[model samples]
Target: MEATYCAGVLSRGKLPVSNLRKSDHGFQRLTSQRKAIASVSCHLSNGLGESSCKSHGFHGGSYHGGAVGKGKDPILQTRCSAGVSMYGESFLESHSHATEDKIGVLLLNLGGPETLHDVQPFLFNLFADPDIIRLPRLFRFLQWPLAKLISVLRAPKSKEGYAAIGGGSPLRKITDEQAHALKMALEAKNMPVNIYVGMRYWYPFTEEAVQQIKRDKITRLVVLPLYPQFSISTTGSSIRVLQNIFREDACLSRLPVAIIQSWYQREGYVRSMADLIAKELERFPKPEEVMVFFSAHGVPVSYVEDAGDPYKDQMEECIYLIMQELKARGINNDHTLAYQSRVGPVQWLKPYTDEVLVELGQRGVKSLLAVPVSFVSEHIETLEEIDIEYKELALESGIKNWGRVPALNCTSSFITDLADAVIEALPSAKAMTNSEGTSEEMDNDPLRYLVKMFFGSVLAFILLLSPKMVLAFRNHLF
Candidate 1:
C-alpha cells in the first residue's frame, strides 16, 4: 500500500535541502537563498526510498529522508533501494534516450569576489546574512544597514588580502572546476546529469541557479553543499533559504529534491585527504617528525553551545578519520586541530590557529604542515590567510620550516568520491508537493498576510517594550 503523507508533515527542517565555508572571507558566503522545498515529504515508488534510507545502516552523515506524500508531482516514480545502484549500467540500459529524468545537482558554495571592485559588495552580501552577525530575529530589519557598515569597514583589509592573492579570490573558478569534474565522474559511471553551481554571495547566486533549474524543468534536484561538515552559520543558513523558496514556489515545492547533509566521513574523502597529507609530507626533511596541523575555519562557540551546531564534532571526527587512514598507512607523526579565520570580538572555537602556531614554535616543534581541513578549494582562506599570513606568523614565531597542504580542488580521488556520494544520495530523493499551493497562491492572500504581519509586528513591539508584562501574564495564566 502506498502511504500518503500530508504536505509539510516532514517537519523540523528535514523536508529542506542545504554552506558558507564558515573563513575570514567567510563573513560567510551564501545568504543561503539555498533552502529548497519546505514541508516536503517523500514520494518514492512502492515506499522503497523510505525503507532503504534506514536499511542502509548509516546515520548522521547520510541523505535526508522524509515522509511520502501523494503525487502532486508528475514525474513517474520508481522503487529506489539502498542496495540498488540503478544509476549505473541499468540506468543507461533502461533509459537509453531518457531525457525526461532531468536530475539537477545544485552545488552550494561560498562565493568570493571576482575582482578588486567586487570585494566590498561580496562582503556586503555576506555580512547582510543574519548568520554572519547573528542578531535576534526582532532586530533583523537592521541587517542590511549594519551589513553595509561592516562591509565597508572590512573591505580595505579584505581587498589587501585579495590583492596579495593576485587581485581576486579563485573560489568561483575552482568551484566551477569541481563541478565539471564531478559531472565527468558521474558521466563515467553512466549517471550523467546537469550540474549547476550556486554561489551564496557572488554572481550566479543560488537564486539564479533556482531560476535556471525552473527554466530547464529539472525533475530531480540534489542540493549538495560543498562544505564537508555541517555548521549552523554555513550549511544551515543555506538550507533555510532553500526551504523558504520551496514554500513559496509551486513548481519547486513539487519537484523531487535530495540533500547530502555532509560527506566528510565518506571513505574516499578521508583517503584523499590522507593522500594529500602523505604526498605533502614527503617534502619535509624528516616526514616522521613533521607535526600535522589541521586548521579548520572557525564558527562561534555559541553556535556549538547555544545552537548545538555539530561542526566541532564533525570536524574532529573528519580529522580523526583522516588521521586513522594515515595511521593505517604507518604515517603517524603527530597532529593537532585548530580553528582559524575568526572575525569579530566574540570568542570563536579554539585553540586559535595563529595562537597555536606561536605556541608550537615556543614549544620547539619544527617542520609543521598546515592542512586546510575545513575548505575544499583554494580561496582567500587557503591562499592568502593560511599560505601568506599564517606562514609569516609561523616564521616569525621561530618555526624553522613550514608547509601547507593544498585544497582538494578537482583532485581525481576527491572528485571521484564526491561522485560516489551523489550516487549514494540519489535513492533518497523526495519530491516537493504542490498540494500546499504555490507562492503565487499565497500572494493572492494579501489581507491574510497583512493581518499576520501586523499582529507579528505588534507582538514584537510588545516583547520589545514590556518584558515585565509578559512575565506577569505568564504567571497569571499559570
Candidate 2:
C-alpha cells in the first residue's frame, strides 16, 4: 500500500538512468515494516516510438534491464541502485516541468458516424466491443457475426434515420466546438491548460490521444469522460480500455494521470442544465402547464441487472437532482424520465421517449419539453433522432408544441460549469510529499482500509454471480 517512487528523464528516445531513495527510516518503528527491500527499474516504450523509464523498490532485491525496440533504436534504458533517495517535498514536483505546468484535460467521448456512409460501420464498432455486448467468449464470436448480419439488415433503415436530419452524425462537429469553447473558457480564467478530445468508438480514439500526449510531452493529465452520469457500459468501458493500454505501453503508464469518474452530482452541472430548461420553458405559451420529459439514451436492461451498471440509477438520480434544482429556482412543473433510441427488439428501459410523447399527446398534454440528459453535445440523437424523428411523431399524435432544449455545446455557462467541475473534482493542486511511506501510511488508516476492503469484496462477489444471472435473465426474457 506504500506509495511507489520513480525518478528518471527521457534520453535518446529511451528512459535514461535514474536514482531511487528510501526514507522509511524517519518513520516510527512498526511490526508491519520490513527491512532490506529490493527495487527494480524498468523502461516502457509505447508502440508509438516513445519511451519512459521508471524505478521503484519492492520487498525483493532490485535489478536493472533494457528493452529492445522493434525499429531504429533501443526504446527504453533503465538502471537500478539500492539505498539511493531522490525524495522531493512535493509529489507533483516529480512530474512537473518548468516549461509547462498547465493541466492537460482530455475529453473522453463517443464518436458517431460522420457521414451517411459511416453510420453502419460506426454502429458495428460500437456493437463489437465485448464490454458492450457482454456475451460469452465463444458466444462473442457469434455475437459479432450476428451483429454484422444485423447491421446489413438494419443499415437501410438506419440510413433513413440519418437522412432524416442530414447525411451525417453531428457528434464530431459538436464535440470539436465543445473542445474549442472549453479551451477558450479555461484561457479566460488564466488556467494554464490544453484540452484534447479522445473518442471511444470512432476517429480520434483514446489510443490516438495517448500518442498525442506522449508527443506533446505533457506531464499531468486529467481525463474527463463526457458522460455526466457514469455507467460501466460507457465510462467504465472507456476507463478499462485506457487502463489496459497504459498497462501494456510503458510510456503512457509512467505519466501521472487522474480520472474524473463521474460528475453527475456537481452543482454547476445541475444548475446549468436547469437553467437551459428554464429558458426553454419561456418559449412555450403556458410555461407552468408543460410536461418536462428527460430522454436519456437507453442501454439493455440486462446490463443494469446482470452487470450491476449504475447507469439507470445514476440517470434517475440526475433527473431527481435537476428537478430539485428547478424547484429551488421556482420553475417546477411536471417532469418524467424516459429512455430513447433503443435498438434491437429486446425490451429496453421504458417508457420509450417516442412512445411517451405519443401517450402524453393522447392524454391531452399539448406542450412538452424534451431534454436529452445523457449527452452534453448535440449529435444525431438530438438533432436527428429527437428533433426530426420524435418531432414528427409528436405532430402525428396531435401534439401542437414539441421543442428540445438545445445541447450544451460551447455555451459560456456550460463551459464555465465544466471547468468548475474539473477543478472541484481534482485534489488540491498544492505541493505535497513524494514519500513512499505516505501511501503505506494512508493504507493503514482504518477508514480508508475498510472502504477498500468493502468495495473489493463486493466487486468480487458480483463477478462470481454475474454469469449465472446473465444467463438466467437472457433465457427468461429473450
Candidate 3:
C-alpha cells in the first residue's frame, strides 16, 4: 500500500472532514491577533494550497496526540513532507523578513576613584596603565612598585585634593547619572539602543564590557569616548586599551565595532559648552567684561613630546570652538586656556590654571568665570581642584566674583547631542556583518614585546633542558 498523508478535522460530537484541496477548502491565513486559534494548513506540492491534506507533520483541530472523537484511525498522522531543504529556505526567508535592525553604542570613560577609602588606590590604578606611564618592561614593573610606594606615601597629600573636594570623587555617581540620562534621551527619540559604559581604570572596565557584549550577542558596537576634547592621553589611551582587549580575546575576534574617536568639533557640543559659560557669565556683575578662563586636564610634557599626543592641541581646538560659538552668539570676550592637575614636579602644559587665576586677580580683573573644557562631568578636578582651590585663590587675590561653568552632566541638550552622535556612529547592518573588530592598540614599546617574547622562550628552553640534564646525570650514575 502507498503511504499517504491526510489533513483531518474533528470537533466535539461532530463528524470528521478529511482530504480537502486548495480549490474546495475554506482556510484562512493566520493573523497576529488570532494566535489563540488552534488551526493548521499546508501549502502542498504541484503549486497548490491544500487545506485538508497535510503535506507536513501538521493536523487540524487541537493538534494533541492519539485519537480524535470516536477514533476510527486511532493514530491520526499528518504526512506533510515538504523536504528539509525547502523548509530551511522558507525559514530563512521568514527570519530575514522578521529581524529588526539595531545599533550598539559603547560609552567610553575614565573610571573614577570610588569611595572615601579608594581614592589613592584608584589614582594608583590610573597612573599604572602603560599608556599613561610609558615605561619599559623592567622599568614598568619598577615604576609600578615605586608608584605603589609613592601612592602610599603621597596618599595624605592626594587626600588633601579629595578632602578639599568633599573627601571623595563624585565621578562615579555623575557618570552613572549621565549614562542613564543619555539612555533615556535616546529612547525618547524612539531610537532604542544599548548604551554601555566602560571605564579605563576601574570596575566595568573596557575588557569586562567587551566580554559582556559577547555574552549579550551584540554584533555591532560603536565606541563613544566621553571626553569632549580628544587627547592622545585621555581618549587615545582608552581606545588603545580597548583595542588590546579585542586582540587578546578569542570570542571577540569576529565581532564588529566602530569608534567615534572624537566629537570635540561638533556644533551641539560646542554650543552646549558655550551656553554653560554664558550662564556662568550671567551671574557676574558684568557679563562681557568678565574674564573667561578655560582649564583642561594636564598630561606630562614627555608623553606629548615622545608620543606626539594631541591632548593640548585638541584642548585648544575645543576651546576655540567654544569661543567661536560664543562669538557667533554675540558674546565675544577675552578667554584663556590653561592646564590643571599637574603632579610630581614635572613641567606640564603651561601657563597653569592656578597661575592664570592669580594673574587675572592680580591684574585687577574683578569677575572671572572658570570653564573646565576637558571634563564633561563634575569630578575631583572640577569640584575640588577648580571650584574650591582656585576659587579660594581668586577670592583671596581680591577678585570679587569667581564661579565655574558646571560640567555638562545630564543636561538635556548635551545628552540629546550625545544620543545623536550614537545614532550617527551606528554601523549599517551589512557593514556590521562584514567587519571584524575591537579597540586595544599594540604597545608602542617594541622592547617590551621583545623582552616578553624572549623571557617566555627562555623559560620554555630551560624547562626542556631540565629533564634531559636530569636523565644524563641518572645514566652517568648508573
State TM-scores per candidate: 0.72, 0.69, 0.68
Per-residue lDDT value at 86 in model 3: 12
lDDT tens digits by residue: candidate 3, 4-33: 001111111112222221221121211112
Once fitted onto the true fold, the runs of candidate 3 whose alpha carbons sit more than 4 angstroms away are: 1-99, 136-138, 428-478
Worst 10 residues of 3 by lDDT: 1-10
The 0-to-1 C-alpha lDDT of every candidate, in the order given, reads: 0.64, 0.58, 0.56
Off by over 4 Å in 1: 1-100, 432-478
Q: Candidate 3 overall Cα lDDT vs. reference?
A: 0.56
- What is the per-residue lDDT of model 2 for residues 380-399, given as tens digits with 9 covering 90 to 100? 77877788888899889988
The TM-score of candidate 3 is 0.68
Pitting candidate 2 against candidate 3, the one with the higher lDDT is 2
Instruction: State how far residue 257 of model 2 sits from its true place (Å).
Output: 1.4
- lDDT per residue for candidate 1 within 1-478, as digits (tens), equals 0000000001111111113221222211112121122211221211000000011101211111111122222112221111112243433333444334777788888777879988887777676655556655434445566667657876778889899999998887788778778888988877768787766566556655676677677787778889888765566555655655565588887886777767776677888899999999999999998989888888777777765566776776666667767877899778888777776555677778888889989989888999988789898888888999999999999898899999999999999988876765565567643343222222347887577667767765675358775554343212
lDDT of 3 at 194: 59
Q: Per TM-score, what order, best first?
A: 1, 2, 3
lDDT ranking, best first: 1, 2, 3
